[model samples]
Target: MSIWWSLHLRREAASVPLARRLLLGTMETAGVDPDVSYDLSVALGEACANAVEHGGGASRGGSSEAYRVTAYLDGEKCRIEVADSGPGFARAHAPRPPRVDAEHGRGLFLIRELADHVHIGDKPGRGGTVVSFDKMLKWTKDPSLLTA
Candidate 1:
């Protein structure tokens, strides 16, 4: 079976963990290995945090600013995308290694390391950012019907 969900959340600190938890629950229910789930959850947290922090600077007057998180689980692969409607940075400027004592600037790096594939791009005309990633799912108990 394939599972998918999308959440349109306010650009706030609380939204980050909410997205992560929802992912965790879905993974757990799907019998994904704990270690794999943990890795993906951390990566999701980083992406969501980035969205909350830098994805909502271009809101028009009176419009409620928000970000979107979408996740898809199909067979042995899971794909996730987080998008925000804010002025975003360019992908050509790759994430740099931060100083050892730095308090921040590690989100994209973590996402790239944890996920099997990561892509960053502009969200079309609105000039927002989108962080999309996918990981090969490992299940402790494989379901016989899932061929892919």
Candidate 2:
């Protein structure tokens, strides 16, 4: 079975967990492995944090800012995308890993490390920036439930 969902959220820190919980519930109900679900949830949080912190343009202002997050699961693979309505970044430039001691700038790096594929781009019609990533899902048997 395939499952998918999309959330249009207010650009606020609190909104990030709402998205993460929904993804976790969906994955659990769909029989996804616990570890895989946890990793994706963390990555999702980072993406949403970036959207809430850096999405949209200055003219748009905080009062009306919003972001969109989508997740799709089809058997052994899952894909997630987070898009914002803020001023977009330069399409040709990729996010560079920050210095090891830097306090911030590690979100994208973590997402890239966890996800099998990552794509950063402009949202449709100059809307804003989009961070899309996918992971190969893996399933592990519950040890207590396994009888040799």
Candidate 3:
């Protein structure tokens, strides 16, 4: 079958590396600028991390399985999906992290903030689910020069 975006596998942290590589290849091949690649990569990485940490990978005692991360690029828009093999997550029950912490429970928020569209089931039924993000190729053209 013609796979538009489908990455199926076990659940593990190391899988994220391959996922990133695949994304880089896809973006590069799609003629996406390096800047766009970087920004998209950031969003992509965060998604993969979430899949591993909050998906099924995190629940595994020490299983070396891998999750699925598939992304599709359509002209100025790119669609990314991350799915793992595990029970569904509670999008409604995820306790919103306190504001004091700058790094907790912010993945979904960041994903939504960066991408044009986001779909988070955080579960894939029997094999878990796939969270998706759609973004453009111009979001990373100019990096901040005031990074001190």
Candidate 4:
């Protein structure tokens, strides 16, 4: 079975957990392994938080008041994408690892560590960042719903 959903959320702190909860609930209902679900939820939260923080400013060319989160569960794999409307990654380089003593700049790195594959880039024909990641799903011993 396959499932997908998308949310256009305000760029606010509260929206982070709301997106995380929905992803968690969906994974739980689909009988995903709890550990896997937790990892994905954490990654989702980080992505959402990043969008809320860096997703808005002087509009480069897109909507500045909201961002988007999309999730896809297909067979043995699950993918998630978080997109925002802010100045794109004009830095022209990958995110550098944060310092151990630093309090920030770890979100992208955390997502890369948790997910099997990650893509961070500018949205096509737009001024924003798009962070996409996917992981191999693990099912519970006895799946209650969708199973691979």
* Among all candidates shown, the one with the greatest lDDT: 4
Model 4 stretches with alpha carbons more than 4 Å out: 60-62, 91-93, 146-148
Ranking by lDDT: 4, 1, 2, 3
In candidate 4, position 26 carries an lDDT of 91
Which candidate tops TM-score? 4
**Model 3 ranges with Cα > 4 A deviation:** 1-5, 57-64, 94-100, 122-127, 138-148
Give the TM-score comparing model 2 with the true structure, all chains together. 0.86
lDDT tens digits by residue: candidate 3, 38-125:
6677788788887677565335543325676777766567788877655666676864644766766777777777777888774532
All candidates' lDDT scores? 0.87, 0.85, 0.66, 0.90
Clashes of each: 0, 4, 9, 0
Clashing pairs in 2: 56-86, 56-87, 57-86, 57-87
Clashes of 2: 4
Report the C-alpha displacement of residue 49, candidate 1, in angstroms. Answer: 0.6
lDDT score for residue 76 of model 1: 89
RMSD value for candidate 2: 4.1
